[model samples]
Target: MNLTTFLVYCVIVTFTPGPTNIVILSSVQHSSMRQAMNYVLGATMAFGLLLGASAILNRMLAGILPSILSTMQIVGCLYMLYLAYQIFRMGSAESLEQHPSGFASGLLMQFVNPKVILFTLTVIPSYVLPYYSSPLILMVFVIIITVIGFLAFATWLIFGSVFRSFLLNHQRAANTIMALFLVYSAVMVSGLL
Candidate 1:
C-alpha cells in the first residue's frame, strides 16, 4: 500500500472542514470539552464500524451503493440543514441555550455521512486493494483509518477549544461561521459543491 498517499488522503478527508469537524468545533465552542469528546467518541466508533462493513462488503458495495447512495446523500443533506439551523440559533446562554448534539446523535449521523461512505468505498478499492486484498488486512486498514478519524475529531475539538475565548467574545460571528460550514457541507453532500 502507498502508506504516505493513503495517510495523506485520510488526513485530508478526515480533518477537513466537513460536517463532522465543523460540528466538533461548534460543540467545543458552545458547550463543554466533555460534551465535545462524547461526540468524538460516538463519531469515531460509528466510522470504524462503517469502514469495516464497507471493506468486508466491497464487492457487494458496488451494486448496493448505487441504489442507496442518493438516499444517504439526501438524508445527510437534510441533517446538515438541521445542524446549520441549530448553529444559527446559537447565542449567549441567557438568550439561547445551545446544547451540544449528544453521543447517540453523533453516532447515527455518521451512517449517512457521504464523505465517510465515499472514502471507505473509494480508498479500500483504489488504495488498499492493489496492495492486499485479504480480509484481515482490510480490517486492519479500517481500524487504522478509524483511529486516524478519531484524531481528526480531536484536532478539530482542540482547534475550537483554543478559540473558546474568541468565540465567547464574538459569539455571533463564530456561530455564523460554523453555520456556514454546515451549509457548505450540505451542498457538498447534495453534489452541488
Candidate 2:
C-alpha cells in the first residue's frame, strides 16, 4: 500500500466541494457558528459510522452494492434537490429556523450523500483492506478516515465563516451559487453526468 497515494486520495476526495461541504458553506453563511458546528459534529459522526460499517461489511456489501447504490442514488438526488430549493429561497428567520442546519439533518444527509457513501464504501476496500485484514488495523484506518472527513467538514466551516460577511452582503448570489453546486452534485450522483 502506497501511503502517499492513499493519503492523497483521501484528502482530495474529502476536501473537494460536495453536498456536505456545500451545505456547510451555506450553513455558515446563513446561520450561526454554533449551528454550523452542530452540523459538523453530526456529519463527522455519521462519516465515522459509515466508515466502520464499510470496513466490517465490505465483503457482504459487494454482492448487493449495485441494488443498494441504485436506491441511494434516487434518494440522494431527491434529497439534494429539496436542499437546493430550500437554499435558493433562503430568507427570513422562519425559513432559517425551519431548515435549520443542525445535527439531525447533518447526520441524515451523510446517509444519503452519494459522494460520501461511495468514498466511505470504497476507500477501505481499496486502500486498507487489501493491505491489512486485521480488525485492529481496519479500526485504526476507519478512525483515520473519519478524522480526515471531520477535518474536511471543519475546513468548509472555517471558509464559510471567513467569508460570512461577504456572503451575507451578496446573500442572493451566494445562495444561488451554492444551490447550483448542489444541483450539479445531484446530477452527477444521479449518473446523468
lDDT of each: 0.69, 0.73
lDDT by residue (tens digit), candidate 2, 79-143: 66765776678662222222469999899999999878877766676566545768888899999
Q: What is the lDDT of residue 146 in candidate 2?
A: 90
User: Model 1 over residues 23-81: C-alpha lDDT tens digits?
Assistant: 77778868888888998899998999888887777635535564444555565566657
Q: Which residue pairs of candidate 1 clash?
A: none
> Model 2 Cα RMSD, Å?
7.6
Q: Which 10-residue window in model 1 sums to the lowest lDDT?
A: 90-99
Model 2: weakest 10-residue lDDT segment is 91-100
Kindly report which residue pairs in candidate 2 clash with one another.
none
Whole-model alpha-carbon lDDT for candidate 1: 0.69
Q: Compared to the true structure, candidate 1 yields what TM-score? A: 0.64
